[model samples]
Target chain A: MGELRRDPVRNRWVVIDPERPDREAALKVEAQPPPPLSGPCPLCPGNEAMTPPEIIAFGESSRQRNQTDWSVRVTPDLQPLCRIEGDFDRRPEGPFDVMNALGAHEIVIESPQHLLTWAEFPEQQLERVLRTYRMRSLDLRLDGRFRSLIVVKNNADAAGILRHPHSHVLALPFIPYGIEEELRGCREFYARKERCAFCDIILHERVSRVRRVVETDFFVVLAPFASRFPFETWLLPLRHASDFGKIGEKELVDLASLVKRTMQMVGKVLGNPSCTIVLHSTPFDEPHTHDYHWHLEIIPKTAPVAAFGWGARLFVNPIPPEEAAALMAQQM
Target chain B: MGELRRDPVRNRWVVIDPERPDREAALKVEAQPPPPLSGPCPLCPGNEAMTPPEIIAFGESSRQRNQTDWSVRVTPDLQPLCRIEGDFDRRPEGPFDVMNALGAHEIVIESPQHLLTWAEFPEQQLERVLRTYRMRSLDLRLDGRFRSLIVVKNNADAAGILRHPHSHVLALPFIPYGIEEELRGCREFYARKERCAFCDIILHERVSRVRRVVETDFFVVLAPFASRFPFETWLLPLRHASDFGKIGEKELVDLASLVKRTMQMVGKVLGNPSCTIVLHSTPFDEPHTHDYHWHLEIIPKTAPVAAFGWGARLFVNPIPPEEAAALMAQQM
Candidate 1:
């Protein structure tokens, strides 16, 4: 089991998972050329036995759990950073605070084929994948120990050796610092103007139109005015919603389309650079927060984050949001 | 010129420096092997004309500025992200805050001999480099527009094309979020215990000794309890100090040795991996804070910062600090 340790000075928690795969070993594996697409991928349909028992699967009714017919499958991570069976066991160690790593880590396998990414999946298959994300999020929230859940995809080379099309759904015991900061900002904004900050952003972007990349019927993809990375974008619903789990079936279909289209555009623009797509929603334990707005942040890893960024929480993005938006819009 | 933009949701500022060299161009330069030690290195002794005029130099008093006899030199960055001569035209665009990027960016050339690193420098030369850092920091603080100063070094391959043995001294108009978080946490800790959090950490580490890598007469280097990266170490003075610029001459010499020793140990253990070393001190504008203690954080870039870290502000460090400390100590 791993443990969560707090930095006394910064008061930030980090998961120290000794059980996680060795970094050097992972790097060595990544250094080799990726296996062939039709190679024995564990996430492929016939290799269901290579993975742990499926927690949930979406496919034909005649097929059994972890069967070939499944289009999407959710399973516990083989080497989870946080285990589901531990008590938090929070305690003090001198000046520092620590606790048992008590949460859930699951993988949402998006395709039955050896496809490399979700963007390459068909519309119907991608819709099932998005629906699976919502279903798993709602299911994980039922666990009282979990306070927050994040759906994140580490696609292509950036994800290391795990090349199959999948996203990770992490149930954390506490709201992460990033989300907490956003929530606090949103609450403050709401207290002052009685409006969600994200909602205000949507309205402002709609009027400005300079940073808007694409506007769909239900979602809008835009380059954030203060994007930390070049070509960084956000996908948000036009209608305000706080929890991803509460998204309607119709909204899920729209979200799937928007996500796929946005990713395709990103790939086209950046020559298929490795990226991280993360869904930010209200914490599972805090469903009643009206100020919070759910959204997806797509960050293309085009450059290395150097000292200036790592040391000072300050980023130097060469590309302006307006220019990035224009370039992305041109791709369409 | 660059502009600073603030993220409305997370309330973090980023410098959008369009004038800075493109990352791809820099990557191309870095892809080539490092220039030979005797090559026409701009930072080397005879090639002083190749770089900007020297702001300060430490060598034979008979030598003229930008001449060959300097052991240590300070010069303005050829391409600075922030310019020194500008008013911070702070304004609001909708809900977002924007300001002119106004600051001083200088490079502290560690040696005239094209030796690639400070670790290989003699103690006396390294001491001069440390003193130069203090002198430049004190000089920059005299400007009232500057609020914070960060002395950072990006060593080895991952730091980018600038392979010369040097450190960056940036004087910023705003205190970065990373420092602000530490200050806030420190203030909160002092409010409750009426003691500096860093002081408590030193005392605790002294007693525990599990995460202590090296302890000297004036400084102690230890792996942080919640280190975000593997083999991350922090060097702090034994006594509480709020400013790096205020270090005594003897303490500067001691810091120089400790820093070199720690870096050497890190290299021996990690096989000369790329790394970043950053100094965190009190903000220049408000210098009377008792809670904030100055320290140097050395982060060895052992692995890629993947999506989970970027999205959640949560880190999954595979190596625990205790284990990392032990490994580093063995190398020493």
Candidate 2:
């Protein structure tokens, strides 16, 4: 396993994975439909031996693991960002901090079939996907070494190298910088207002409804007020919950329907642009139950990353959130 | 004009430029060599009328404004991320905070000719470029509405839509989040150790010299200890300086030479990869004089922005800085 290094003078961590494959492989994914796979499609049902042995799979009650009959499956990432084993050994390298890249990286195959986009994923299938996500989150968090975990889905021609619809579960030894910022901000806001910052935003957005894109029984999907990208949509649960592992099945079903519809709208209005779906839950070990609210963000990759704001980490969106919401309404 | 919006629960700010031009044009830059200039090259000598009126230029003693005789020039961005006018208005849109995109965005034409890359810039011409950055920075600071400014240069074939060798000057009404974080880190370190964080980094780096790529009279260019990307280089001033505008004429000459040589190495080793050159100067009107040190960071566009870290604000580097340094040394 490689190691993680802390920026000497900044609050950022970087994982130096010398074993990363020629990342150029992902870029070629679009051009090579089968993704330059060795034999048959590794993700497809019959190619069970192709990928690392399945970690978990949901299929017929009569069937065994790694079967073609499976609906959803999870496996160790062939190109893991962080390895599965290590003592999160942190030592000082001169004046800088360094630690082993200890945690888990797994692939959540949303479907065993090719050509199925999230927009086309059935509500039942998406619900299964969410369950798989929660299962992996819970399982990974059980490891005392991991501090944070995320379920990230990349769906775009540019970024979606794998034609087979899927997501990735990344468990890290520490909470990421952005999450730490939000945790700090929410903690301070709660200290002052005695309410969760996300709950306040949900209430405000519901009342204003300017950037609201969709709302279900248990979730409210909205274009965030300060969207970093055009058509940037977010899904926040109506209830105040910090941990994703605590999500109930009924809530997951509601979320799955809302996600399916939201993705369909995104595809219809935005021509199915490349986008990222990120699940931000409370860190594994943190129990700031009332101060933080878990949420999901869907960011359309509408702009290049090499813009002027790259250095500053500020984003420049070509369109405002209200207008984006209106665009979604038009398509709806 | 566009406006800046703060993320409701986080510290990040984003610009919503409704009038932004076709950003995809930059993607097409590599395909269009002269970059599809409508008429004559805008930055070239005689066609200076094509761009927004020139702000400053340096050339022959007898030359007039916006003349073909200039060696280097500066102009307001034709399509700025933030407008040059407007009061720095801050208001609440429901539960979120926002302000007008009040700032100056100028283009610094590094060379008169379109074909000259920074690596090919003559030392004298590059010095003129640095002088132009300082002049505009100082001029923009006088506005009092601006809080921080960065001199940014994008020279990748993928991002360099304007074929002319140039950089940008962005002055914002607030310090960007990255700069703010650095300032906070530096201040906290100073409080604890009574030493400038960057000064200690410079000392540690010089003593180890493991990641040092080049050193000159006034600058040491090194692969930062925890580089976010492979070959992500930082050029730190040898002297403890907190403000970029305070750089003297002699130091400017040394910096120019170092910059030129470093760019040459980056070009040779990285195959003229697209990269961002950012100057992190002290924010205007703030004087944490002893705690901070201004520096420049050069990040290679080796990875896409839509990576998983896009959500976490963490970074995953494929290679370690030591190996990256070795690669640089091999080329040198």
- List runs of model 1 lying over 4 Å from the truth: A1-39, B1-39
In terms of lDDT, model 1 sits at: 0.74
Q: What do the candidate models score in CA lDDT, each in turn?
A: 0.74, 0.73
Q: How far does residue A152 in candidate 2 sit from its true spot (Å)?
A: 0.9
lDDT of 2 by residue, B250-329 (tens): 99999998888888787776667677888998889786689889999888665453366666665555555666677676
- Chain A fold similarity by TM-score, each prediction: 0.87, 0.87
Span of ten consecutive residues with least summed lDDT in model 1 chain A:
A23-32
* DockQ comparisons of all candidates to the true complex: 0.19, 0.20
Q: What TM-score does prediction 2 earn?
A: 0.88
Q: Can you write out model 1's per-residue Cα lDDT over A186-279, one digit (the tens) per residue? A: 7877778788888888999989999999998888999877766667799999999999898998888888888888877877777677778888
Give the distance in Å from residue A101's predicted Cα in candidate 1 to where it truly belongs: 1.2
